[model samples]
Target: MLNLVDSRSVIKIIPYELIMDTVNEHSCHRPKPTVVTISDLLATTNNDDLRFALLYDPPSVVLHQCGGSGCCQSKSETCTHSEHEELFLEIAYLSDPDYVKKTYLLAWNHTACKCAAKNNNRVL
Candidate 1:
């Protein structure tokens, strides 16, 4: 069970079903599942929804974990589209067998890359 705290102690029992009603436990990695829906992926990155993901945290905090690429390996630096996608795909690949069958990994990867590239192409 998760608990929201006033000062580092678990004060209130936050239900395990979700970090909140809007966010599902599976999406938040409660059991650390993979193969999230596109909407789930978007929520994790957006500045607003991400803040409430944890039981305790402020909107100003943005979290990034290490990605294997050595170009600019610091987790502190904001992640690029490729890096984020790679991490997402990796988890889904390892943890969700259905993900490969449903999305057809290679095709999905290609499509996602194209979409990301198109988004990057936006200049205004």
Candidate 2:
């Protein structure tokens, strides 16, 4: 179980890559880039400003798919999932300056735990 501090810190880091992956896998159509509009829509939330800061400009295309369905077919192009992943990771990481420290610490802890687990398994 993650400790309170660790859990809280990790929560600050949104797993945007995972989200994108899930969207890609499940959605019949590509997810829309509505971060700006979403931020506008949720302006009342406590972290609305932060959310907006974290909001990434949805990639123009993913897997050859354009912003909309019919567009990609006409262009005979596909969205680049790898590029989208990179962009999303960049945006997510860039969103919160303050959270950066916490994220790093959390990552270090996770690595340490994984390493320790690996060592224990080897011993066993």
Best candidate per lDDT, number? 2
Q: Per-residue lDDT for 23-48 in model 1, tens only?
A: 33212111111232433443534344
lDDT tens per residue, model 2, 20-108: 67555643234343223333323454654445465334321222222232122223443322112212222232366555311110100
| Candidate 1, pairs of clashing residues | none
Per-candidate local distance difference test = 0.28, 0.31
Candidate 2, clashing residue pairs? 62-79, 63-78, 63-79, 64-77, 64-78, 64-79, 65-79
Q: Which whole-number lDDT from 0 to 100 does residue 95 have in model 1?
A: 23
Candidate with top TM-score is: 2
